[model samples]
Target: MKTRIVRVLVTDDHPIVLDGVTLALQNTPWLQVAGYARSGREAITAVERLKPDVVLLDLRLPDMLGPEVVQALRAQDSAVKIILFTAYPDHAALDAALAAGAHGAVVKDTERDDLVDAIRRVMAGERVLCINAAGSSGAALSRKLREHGLTRREYDILRRVAMGETNPEIAVALGLTRNTVKTYLQRTLEKLGARNRVEALSRASQLGIL
Candidate 1:
């Protein structure tokens, strides 16, 4: 008997990641790339129109978070299984994705064979969590970030900084003094193991702070 081809819709804000995954799945015998999308809205539209059997989604999207997208897809009452495919992996993110109705979780670096296995498992009504996630802390900056004891306001400032805001601009926007903004940014960097704004933002984004 011929094996069934599992139709999949892949979503990611980064075009390169989306194309890479789609191409990887193209040769899988039991899987078919139903379609691919670049953002949360496009992913939703594709799901509505194509109704693929499974959806591979990115956690941090331009318009919506991965959990938000998962919830939205579930709200549509579609039986299409969702797998959170992200570059950053941790226990917290995976838990959130699962809570939002994702059937599995995989990172960007997942081996093609492992990715194929994840999709196959999800199609068979199993919840799949990639190997990397098993030992990951899942929280932003891993738990050590929290150990530094940064405040929520500090994280907020760092998030804005990640979006490319300057100290003066952040101060103006947050109604704080320039000194205060500078102080917060420095503290955030120190706590997150960053030497500068770029490194801070990169590390924080990896930990899902952004």
Candidate 2:
């Protein structure tokens, strides 16, 4: 039987990382670098256009964060496997991305062989989270998100607010009523112990909940 090639769209801002990853993927006979995207929007667009089998996404895109990109991509195509390819594996952002429905994560400096293995495993219906050196601190980050007690909707609202989206805009984007968006925002603020949106964002940032 012929080996099937997995098409992968890699999204990262740094040219050097992009080039290196692309080269690494190219070295594998069964993996194809379907396309490259430097920002979250471009990744979404490329996924829509190319319909790649897998997406290797950077956690910090110029436009959107890792979790946001994961949510957006999953919204568009539930079948496409997403892996958060980030340098900050110990950060709360990785936890958020996994919660947002990525297949898993692989640290940016992961071995090329292990990266390939991870992609293959994900394709084979396994979740792969590769945070080798993060140790117990990564577990602590996951705990922090849960301890905040922010529902997914509330977290979504908080992130939107951080992006400067008005309630009406958030409502439209989330497909919720304006009042519903306000309610979620209020819940988020209360959870963060803030009197207002700005303070909420500040506190969330300080707590690494953002």
Candidate 3:
């Protein structure tokens, strides 16, 4: 039986980058290029019309930043999957994207196959982050915090909170109740020896967890 193709919308201000992404997706059997856009407004329009399963979004759109674009898309349709594509993969940026409801992130310099793999993984319902490219700092932070004995879920919640997401947003993303999110946040704070969310975020950054 033939596999279903994952429809994708590619958005970037640069024509060359857009072409490169289209070419890469063309080589992947399970991915179908549905549309391309050169600006945030165009991307939003295409998303509204095409409703592709995945959107490969560049962080530096001509009209808007990637995080804002993702937030706008999410506000329009909560189920729309957005994969942040960028050259700069700083922890702060990654956290912003996550908070804005992006499903995955891939660096612009990522290998073609790895990019394809990320798309497939996100399609398969796994949150994808290019750890080597986009998350080295965050990964190191996570490692240091692991020594403190925080549960995986609590750690995840803490990271999300550090990214500026509210408990309700984190709960929705993680499929936890509002009270459960609060409880996890409290436990995470205790584990990090933090007095508050801001303190925890700062400590996590120092320890390399954000």
Candidate number with greatest lDDT: 2
Per-model TM-score on C-alpha atoms: 0.67, 0.75, 0.64
Task: Show pairs that collide, candidate 1.
Answer: 90-138, 91-138, 92-138
**Which tens-of-lDDT digit does each residue in 1-210 have in candidate 1?**
978878999888777887899788989888888898888888889999988899898888777555557878877656989988877675334555565588888888989999999998888889888857564644544463475566767866765564456888889888999999988888888888889887876675566555
Candidate of highest TM-score = 2
Which stretches of model 1 miss by more than 4 angstroms? 138-210
Residue 174, model 3: Cα distance from true site in angstroms:
19
Clashing pairs in 2: none
- Sort by lDDT, top down from the best: 2, 3, 1
Worst 10-residue lDDT window, candidate 3: 133-142
Better of 2 and 3 by TM-score: 2
On residues 61-154, what C-alpha lDDT tens digit does candidate 3 reach at each position?
6565455678888877777788988876754446656767999888898999999999889888999987555556456435655677777677
Worst ten-residue run, lDDT, model 1?
A: 136-145
lDDT of 2 by residue, 1-210 (tens): 999999999999999998999888898999999999999899999999999999999887767666778888998899999998888766666666776799978899899999999999999999988877445434666577688887767877877776557999999989999999988888888888899987897787667666
After TM-score superposition, what is the CA distance of residue 77 in candidate 1 from its true location, in Å? 3.5
